[model samples]
Target: MWIFGYGSLIWKVDFPFEEKILGFVKGFDRRFYQYSTDHRGTPENPGRTVTIIPAKEDSRVYGIAYKIRDSDIEDVVSHLDFREKDGYERKSVMFYPISSDQKPFEITIYIANQDNINYAGYADLKDIAKQVVKSVGPSGPNIDYVFNLADAMRTLFPSVKDNHLFELERNVSALLNESSIRKST
Candidate 1:
């Protein structure tokens, strides 16, 4: 079985896999529409996180795909299930690798749909940035999550464009800079 990681999973992989491929899945647009109360914020104030929305037009979200060893499938799946229990549900999608010689294959993705209780559902980049800047949870600062995922994407797949994600990162960076400037002054 295979698993896809488009967000934090890109930078933080706790599970063991036989192989990893950098690729993309179609028909979805990554957006900061999910609230991360468990990982990046408290229940009182939630942090913004990426959750793929079904796009009207064909869209591609680039990320890493891990091929689980047959023996480790059970353990890996169980770990992911608990980690993504907040509002995410597992769905299978085709992953297209960057290499030309590789063929597309089905992989499991965790998606937090609008119906989920933790769903923040569509907010502007600045608003999302503000939330991310101030929130922190058991996992640590929300800002780190945004920065890490953004950096990983740019470093791993420079050609692919994820406007929402990149724009959010820019907005968050600006907010942080402004905050530091204000503090210094």
Candidate 2:
């Protein structure tokens, strides 16, 4: 069974997996809509997805593809279904490899509800900052999601650099600092 990781699962896979390969899916993009109850939750209720949409651009989303045992696929799918909620759908995607020698693979992708989507396009640093700061899911703040993505990207594909998330994080941190100062005043 093949599993795709575009967010926290990229860095934090508690389960055992066989192999991980770098892959990308075109047209669709990644966002921090899924929340984390494990990291920051009130105990009673946890982990949820925030309403966020991908940017309207011709870009590739980098993620890891894991080959798991067929027996374990059920467990993994169950866990993912719980995390993604009922609205999200799992669709198969063709993952293109970054290396010329490597072959592409097909994997499942979790897509959000497009009928009512929340577009998170950053017009400037401030817009990106606001999106990061305000975005929260069943899990936690969207910042954690970005940090996880950054960590995974560094570990898995050190040579490949994607700054869309990092730039947003920087903008959010700056905005957070400004907000704190304003609050103090």
Candidate 3:
């Protein structure tokens, strides 16, 4: 079974799977539209989604491909289903290998249905930072996931610079400070 990761999964792999290749998917871009209620639950429930938008010119997203045991596919799918909720459906994606030596691979990607889901467009560093700082999900605060993704992006692709992530960190810090002051008052 093949697994494609574009966000937090790129850095944090709690499950076991063989890493296949680092790759890029063209014609689509990533955003934080998916609410992470499970990972960072709001006052209520857990949820998440991947909002795909038109890929920007000269912009390519870096992600990882994994080959998992066939038996594990069901479990992963179930877990993803729970995370994504009713609006997302699993579909095939063409992933171009990042390495000069490797060929492109076709894998599955979870895409959100625009009719029911919110799309957070390609967020700039400041926007993303602000979102990360202010958002909370069922599992925890959203900023933790953002920081991890930013770190992973830097570690995996040295050339990639995410000012939005940096801005997110700074903004979140300020928000946290304000929250503390409010609580104290």
What TM-score does model 2 achieve against the real structure? 0.71
Candidates, ranked, lDDT: 1, 3, 2
Compared with the true structure, all predictions reach lDDT values of 0.91, 0.64, 0.67
Ten-residue region with minimum lDDT total, candidate 3:
41-50
Clashes of each: 0, 11, 17
lDDT of 3 by residue, 35-80 (tens): 5544554535433334555566656667888877887888887887
| Predicted model with the maximum lDDT | 1
Residue-wise lDDT of candidate 1 within 1-185, one digit each (tens)?
Answer: 99999999999999999999999999999888889889999899898788898985578999999999999999999999999888999999999999999999999999996888999998778998999999999999999998999899989998877788888889999998999999999
Report model 3's TM-score to 2 decimal places: 0.76
Query: How many clashes would you count in candidate 1?
Result: 0
Runs with alpha carbons beyond 4 Å of true place in candidate 3 = 43-50, 56-58, 118-128, 162-170, 173-185
Tell me how far the alpha carbon of residue 81 in candidate 2 is from the true structure, in angstroms, after superposition.
Answer: 1.3
Query: Higher lDDT: candidate 1 or 3?
Result: 1
Candidate 1 Cα misplacement greater than 4 A, ranges:
none
